[model samples]
Target: MPWIRSHITALLATLLVATYAAATEPPLSLRAVTAENNEPFNIVFNGKLQGLGVDVANEAARRSGFSLQTEALPWARALETARQKPDVLLFTVARTPEREDWFHWIGPIAKREVWLWRLRTRKDVMATSLDQAKQYRVGTSHNDAATEYLLAQGFEQGLNLDITMHDRAIGYKLLASRVDLVPMNPLSIGAFARESGIPLEDLEPQMLLISSGGYYLALNRLSKAETVAKLNAALVEMKADGSLQRLLEKWQPKGSKARSPSSPP
Candidate 1:
């Protein structure tokens, strides 16, 4: 009787473990996506997604005990699809107030600043304030949250704003005087300029557009709340263990690099 009682207890423990594992194990694979050609954040390297954002997401998913299947999509498409779909993973996203309530947010995975860059050679072009800078032709990336933030601040296109395919291309447009000004961040701007044969010293941050914001791993509004919680927990652990810091450093650029992005809290 005693042996049977002990055996029943053992069986109960095994069943409990199985149930917990089932509850916590992530789905076979989750569809993950990041903006196409948005380097240092999301980009295909050697035919695979391998950027700071992708690396961080992969680690977070691993810590959470799941696997992430990543895809590269254009900025606009990535945003729209993630907005409409569920359980889809979108990362390295800047958390904005206009979009605060839309997604199930998970992190301050990274930090970046969106600033207005102007040609240093253009002495005739100087603005002490954003309003003064608004008078010139400004180039921005399509669907970039920084652009949206500017829109919220009354930056108008055609009249003054020029939407471009790539935010980094704005640097080229500026060098050619195609646009008087452009909006970009430090993380990839230097590389963008180098690739375009434009000197980094030629451009300078003229205005602090978005002081600072956290880039997050955002889930669609329709995602399971439990799933969100699981991802968040894994991320919290990452931050606690210093893996997050290491990931940031791994993506940190070397020579001919732009400004370094600060760590998010």
Candidate 2:
């Protein structure tokens, strides 16, 4: 009977220790999602992740005292995974009413502009007006915000093209007079042009269509609310102390043209 009593006490002590350890330890892991093909934002380089989204996520994790692990997946797949995983986060997401209920958003950590580019040789299409642009066909990437926004604005004459190879083809298409305009994100276009040795003078944004759109870090609704709140507080602190802006500027492409003050209406 004494041996039985000693065993019971030992088991109770073990359980108590386990409970205390669980209560005191921070979450062991955090998952983040990013597009497999997004460059200058989120991309894999020589078996490691690099880009603005990666930088922002790393900083957020450091500030929040958590370990972050990333998985490169298709944009849709990444978003879906984040939606289903309780401890997952998604980076560089654009907040929209359509997505408001899908996840808990933590920031507008970065901003980007949507612009229309055309070959300098085509001065007619280069004229500063969306109405004038309507006279010719435009090329845009599939499943992109620029495409959706343009279509919503009644620009029906557009060619859907794959984003990965669009830059290589855009200049040639414009030079050949096959497409009048190519709408793209400014940072991406600049990065593509530089990496491919295409001169910016050869392909420049004819008009800055949208001034700014915010990018966010999103947490799955199933994630612990306390964790999400702590992360948000860290992000706010980063912003207040200018760490966020400094990080973004560090990754911003060098000599990238600022949005032109005079943009086409």
Candidate 3:
């Protein structure tokens, strides 16, 4: 009877180990970066950081029982830090083949559409097709994925500018008839124009450049796989429960309507 009991105890212990491996694991810690003064996507308010990407990251942390620490850094620097530090993460990154191997990606958090926009007064810039728009100079951000794509396609990159400088420069050039077109995201361009006192009506979409790929929460390669896996599971849970949709609507820019499941580009 004693031997039988011993055998049963050992079997139970093995099963427990297997169950533990399959269930939700314990908490972990993560570091994330955002712009020093960026808003709507990630921002600091009342001494606390909060925004769409922040909310998503916090939710993921809570569901996974992890602690999140966010810091404000320049866009290019933030991405570089994430790439260099094993503990760091970057959000809302547009995934590309070149970046696919850079980190462990965990999402398609948000989506946007890139566009070629021109001043309404610019008659020569009007185009029925992307090929036609290629004939004109398009203002773009240096080191941006859109810029890379445009360059690869033989579209002449005009007035290389940083992300922070692109808006004002683009608007001035458009109004002064310097550059033929400026490539930007619709929602972002609209928001910037309104904030800077530029009339939105003056801008017209020439051609849809490409479907902006969804945003992602990426982990550095040196980060623990178990930690990343837990966060990933949390994301899947959020997506299934419609929490992600509600978050998107809450943070989306004014006058921009939410896309339905049935809508086409």
Leading candidate by lDDT: 1
Residue 93 in candidate 3 has what lDDT? 68
lDDT of 2 by residue, 1-265 (tens): 9999999999999999999998788855787888865667887889888888888888888788787878888777787888888889898776655577988888888775777887666667753677766666777655556666667667774343223234556556656777777776666767656554667677766776765546788988888998899889989999999998888787766666533424442
Q: Which ten residues in a row have the lowest lDDT in candidate 1?
A: 256-265
Better of 1 and 3 by TM-score: 1
Please, what are the lDDT tens digits per residue for candidate 1 over residues 33-105? 7887777877776887778888889988877767888878887888888999999999879899988887998
**Clash pairs of candidate 2?**
none
Find the candidate with the highest TM-score and give its number.
Answer: 1
CA lDDT for candidate 2: 0.73
TM-score of each: 0.86, 0.77, 0.78
lDDT string, candidate 3, 1-265, tens digits: 9999999999999999989976756556677886643446676678877788889988998898777878877677887888888857787666776677788988887775677777777877776576777666666654566776776676653333223244566566566666677776654665556554558777777777868566788888888888789889999999999999899889877753224212464
TM-score, cand. 3: 0.78
Candidate order by TM-score, highest to lowest? 1, 3, 2
Give the Cα RMSD of candidate 2: 5.5
On lDDT, who's better, 1 or 3? 1
